[model samples]
Target: MANLIFPSDFEWGAATAAYQIEGAAAEDGKGKSIWDTFTHQKGNILNNDTGDIACDHYHRYQEDIALMKEIGLDTYRFSISWPRVLPAGKGKVNQKGIDFYKRLVNQLLEAGIKPAATLYHWDLPEQLQLKGGWENRDTIYYFQEYAELMYSELGDLVPRWITHNEPFVVSMVGNLFGEHAPGYQDYNKALQVAHNLLVSHGLAVDSFRESGIKGEIGITLNLNHVYAKTDSKEDQQAKDYCDAFNNRWFLDPVFKAKYPTKLLALYQDKFGGFEIETGDMEIISREIDFLGINYYSRAVVEYAEDELLKHKTIKPEQAIYTAMNWEVYPDGLRDLLIRLNKEYTDKEIFITENGAAFADQLAADGQVHDQPRVDYLREHFKAAYQAIEAGVPLAGYYVWSLLDNFEWAFGYSKRFGIIHVDYQNQQQRTLKDSAKMFKQVIADNGLTD
Candidate 1:
C-alpha cells in the first residue's frame, strides 16, 4: 500500500541532456561543442573516453521514446545541443539538427507526453568558446538569437521552456574549478561568466514573451540545503557564505534583481565587482512562470581560514554516499523546497534533476537488481510528498536521467540511470529495479510498498 500520494495533476517525468546522450557529434552538419573538444584532449576525461557514440541516442531516440512511453512518463525534459542546431553557435541554422528535435518532440506528443525543452545545458558551441564564450557580453545576444530561433521553430510544440540549466556548474565548475569544458581557473572570469549567463537567461525570457509563445519559461538551478557543521559562530558564518555563494548568488539576481549585499561587498573588495551595466538588473529579474530546482544532496560547511569564501564543504563521517561521493540526504530536498517557498518566488517548483549514480551490474538473466537506487528514489519521493503537504507548490519531479550516458569529465565511469546501459554490448538498455519501481510510482502517482 502507498499512503503518500501526489496530487492527481502532478507531473512525472525524466530528463536528459543532448550532449550526454545524443552521440552524432558530427552527424547532421553539427559543429563541435566545447565538450567535443574537451573530451578529445589528453588527460581531460577518465580513460580519455569521449561521447563520440554515447548511447547513440541521436540515432536511437525513437527506441528511447518507446521506453519512456512504457515507463508512463507524463513529460520528457530534454536539452537542445547548441552546436547541433546552430553549428557556429550563431547564424547558419542547421535544419537537419532542428528537424531531429522536431521529430523527437513529435514522438513525445504522440506518446501523450509533454515536451519540456531546455535551451542550454552547458554545451557551448565550440565557435562560441573561441569568442570567449560566456565571459564575453556578446555571447548574451547570441544566446538570445538562438533561443528566438528555437522558439520560432518549435515553440508551439514545447509548452515548457527552460532557458538554462545549472548556471552555477557552468560558471563555477567549468571556470573557477577548471573541472568541465573550456576549463578556466580564474575567479574574476568565473564571476563574469556567471553574470553573463544570467543576463542571457533574461534575454531569452524576453524573447519568448515577445514571440507570444504559448508556453512557460524558466531557469533550472542546481541548489542544495546548506548546513553548518557545528553551533559555533564561525561555522554559522561559513554556512551563510556557502549558501550565498551557491544559492543566493543566482537566486537573488533572478528573483530580487540584485546580488546579496553581504557577499557582493566581499566580492567587490576582493575581485573588483561583477560587471553590471545599466538596466541589466532590471532585465535579469524579469518575472518567470516557474522555478526549476535540481537537488542532489545537501552541503555541510565549516569555517576555513585562508580560503577565498572563508568556508569549505565538509563530509559528515559515517554517512551514506552515492557513487559520486555525494551524501544522500533526502530531507535536504524537503528543506530546500520549504525554504524556497518561504524566501524565494511563489511560482511552482519542479525537481528538474534528481537521482543517484550507483555501481550497477547486469546479471546473466538480463536484469539489474539495483535496490539501492530504488531506495534512494523512494526516500527522495517521500521528501517531495512532504514538501507538497507543507504547501510548497511543488508541481513536478524529473529524474536526473532516463538513460546511462556520458558522465562528463568522469567520462562513462559513473552510472546515474535507472535503466542500465550496457556500453560494451551495443549500448543495450535494461530496466533496473529502480526503473521498475519508478514505473509503479508513475502509475500510482505516488510511492508504493
Candidate 2:
C-alpha cells in the first residue's frame, strides 16, 4: 500500500494521447490524421509499425480507467484527436468525436479523478496538413474553433485545459527536422510553423476566456535544460543556442509578447523574424495560468562553432542516452525548473512528461521490469521535489504515459509507459516497477531516500 505522503493537493496521474492509444483509426466518423497517413507510409515509421490498433484503447477505455483507479491515480490527462472532432480539421463538428471524449471525461469523473484535457497533441487533421498545416495562418483559426467547440462541450467537467502539447516539437521535429508527421525540412517553414502555433495558442487562450469557461488553461513544452560542457565561453554560447531553440522561442512569446532576440538574430533571414501584424504579440503575451514543463533530461553543450551546429543544435558528449537517443541527466530538470522560475516565467510549473523509454518486458508474474525508467523518474522526481522546495510554484506531476502505446515513428519499440500494454493481443496492462515506484512517491507525497 502507498503511504499517505504527498501534500493535501498534489496531483498524481498518467497521460495519454488519442493517436497513440485509441485504435479505431477510421471508426465512427473519425477522419484521417497526419499520424494515420504518416504511419501508413512505408519507411516512415520503424518496421512500418502503425497505430491502427494501438492498445485498442478506444474499446478498452473503461478497462484503462479501471487500471487507473487500481493504481490510485488522482488525475487523468488525455488529448482530443483533431480529426476525430472535425474530420476535415474545419467545419462541421463530429458528434462522434465529442461523444468519445464525453465518455472518457465522464469515466474519469466517475472514478473520482480530475480530467486534465489537452486540446491538441500532435495529431493534426490530414486535411489541414494538405493546406500547409501549422505553416498556414488559416490553421490557427481552425484550431481556435476546435478549442471553442471543446470548451463548449466538455469544459464544465474538465477543470484544467492544456492548449497545445509541445508546439516546439510539432514545429521542430515535424517541420524543421522532418522526423515526425507531415515531414518537411525547410527552416523557413519551421519558423513559420512556430509563429503560427504561438498565434493559435494565443487565439485559443483568448477564445477560451471568451467562452467564459471556469478553468485553468495553459500549454505544455518539452524542455531540455542544457548545460555547458565546461566553463568555456564557447560552450556557454552553445548552451545559449540550445536554450533559444528549445525553451526561449515559445516561452518568450507566451510570457513576453516577443520572440527571443537571441533566436531571431540566428534565424532572421531564414524565417524573416516570424512576421507579426499589429497586436499579435500582445495576443500571444497574455498571462497563462501555468506552464507545463516536460523534463526528461538535459543536453550537454560542446562548442561546434560550425555554421550548422553554431545556431541549430547543441551536440552532447554524454554516452548515456534513451531509446530515442536523448541523454539522461537528472540535474537538467532542476536546472530548467529553477531557470524558468528565476530567469523566465514565474508561472506555476508541472513536470508534465518525465519518463524514460527502455527495453522492458512482462515477467512471469505479469510484472514489468523497467528498472532504467524507475531510476530515471526517481532521479528526476527528486529534482522536481527540489524545484517545489525551492519555491517554484509547482502544482502536480504526471508521467509521460499510462500504457505502452504507439510511440510515433519509433512505434511500439519505445516503451515510455508506466504500464505495459501487449499490442498483439490488445490486452489491458500490468503495472511496471516504475509504476509501483511512482505509487510509492505519490503515497509519500514526496521523494523519500
Candidate 3:
C-alpha cells in the first residue's frame, strides 16, 4: 500500500464517556444515573459486572490526561454525567460535580489539549428517567436547561460541544431492544424517545447559539453502511428499509428537516403517527455548525417476511470479526462518509468515535501487544483518507476511547481502548502497541505502513 496522509489541520484525538469511566458512583452528592440503577438489577449486565469502579477515572483523571498528552492527542473528548451536575435532575446545581469537570478541563488546557465535551452520553439522571425519560416531551426542556447550565459553566473553556452521543442507541437499544440502561421494549415508545432526543438536540443547539458561546455545537449519530445481501429486488428493498430504520431515522430529520417517508408510512399503523406538537419539527431541524459521526461496521441485509423491519442482517462468513462480532470492513467507513457528503448536508464531519474491540491481554514481557487493533485502526485511517480525497469535508477523528473502561451492557468483558486497563489491579494503565502506533500517526498526520 501507499502512505495515507490527512489534511495538515485535521484533528487527532480520543474519546470516553462519563458513566463508562468516571466511577465515583455515589461520591460528593453525585446522584445515581440510569446506568447505575440498571446495573444493580440481577442479570442485567454481562457477568453481573457494574461500573461502580470502572477505571476509577473520577480520582484518576489527571493520570488519564497525562496519558492523552503523552499520546500526542490534539483533543480529548469526554462526557458530563447528567446526574452529577443536577443531582435531582433539575432545580439546583451541584458545585462539587461542576468543579470536577472544571479541573479536568483546566488540566487538558494546561497540557495543550483542546477539550471536547459531550452533554449526554446515555447517562440520564435517574430522577429524569423516573418521570418517563426521553419518551416524555418534558425531558426535552430538562435537557435544554442542562445544556444551558453546562454552557454557562464550561462553554468558554471547551472548544467543541456535542449535544448528544448516539441517540439512536439510546432510543433503539435502551428503549426498544431492552439492552441498555432504563431498558424498555416498545416500538411506539422508541419512536417517541427518538423524536424527543432530536428535539432536545435542537434545543441545545439553539441554547448554545442564544448564549453566544464561542465554540461549535453538534450532535453525534452512530451510522452504518447498509448493503443488500444479493441483487434480488426483495433484498434491495430490505436493504433500503434497514437503512431508513438505522441511518435515515436519525440523519434525515437533522439534515433534511424531515423523516424518511418510507419509514413514516410503514410505521404509521404501528406508531399511530408521530406525536408531533406545534413547532416540534422546526426545533428538530435547527441548523448546527457540524455533524459528528460514529462509524463501526456495515450491515448486509436480506429480505425477511417475518421480521418487524422486513430485513435480517447476514454476516459474511469469510470476513474478519472483532471481539464485538462486527465485521472488519474498513471500506464501509469511506462509503458512509462519501454518501453522507453527497446525500446529506455539506457541513464539516468529525468522526466522533471509531475503534475496534479485541480480547487483549498483558503479556509477561511487561507489554500489551495489540497488533490486531493497530491493523484495524490503520485500515480505517486509510478509508478516512480516501473519503477526504474524494471531496468529503472530513475534519477530525476521535478514537472511541482513551482507556478500556466499562463497555455498557457488555460490562468489563470487552476492551476497545488502545491503552489497556488492568481492571483487577487498581485499574493500572498500560500503553499498548496500538497506542504507540496511533501517537506516530498523529505526529505524521497520516498512516504509515
lDDT of 1 at 134: 95
Q: Count the backbone clashes (under 3 Å) in each candidate.
A: 0, 3, 0
Candidate 2, residue 309: Cα displacement in angstroms equals 5.1
- The residue-by-residue lDDT of candidate 3 on 179-287, one tens digit each, is 9988899888989999999999999999999999898999999999999999999999999999999999999999888899988987896668768888888898899
- Those runs of model 3 whose alpha carbons end farther than 4 Å from true positions after fitting are none
Cα displacement (Å) at residue 70, model 1: 0.5
User: 2 or 3, which is superior by lDDT?
Assistant: 3
What's model 2's TM-score?
A: 0.95
Q: Please state every model's RMSD to the true fold in angstroms.
A: 0.9, 2.2, 0.8
Q: Please, what are the lDDT tens digits per residue for candidate 2 over residues 208-229?
A: 8898889899999888877777
Better of 2 and 3 by TM-score: 3
Per-candidate TM equals 0.99, 0.95, 0.99
Q: Which scores greater on lDDT, model 1 or model 3? A: 1
Candidate 1: pairs in clash: none
User: Candidate 1: minimum summed lDDT over ten consecutive residues — where?
Assistant: 1-10
The superposed Cα distance between candidate 3 and the true structure at residue 141, in angstroms, equals 0.3
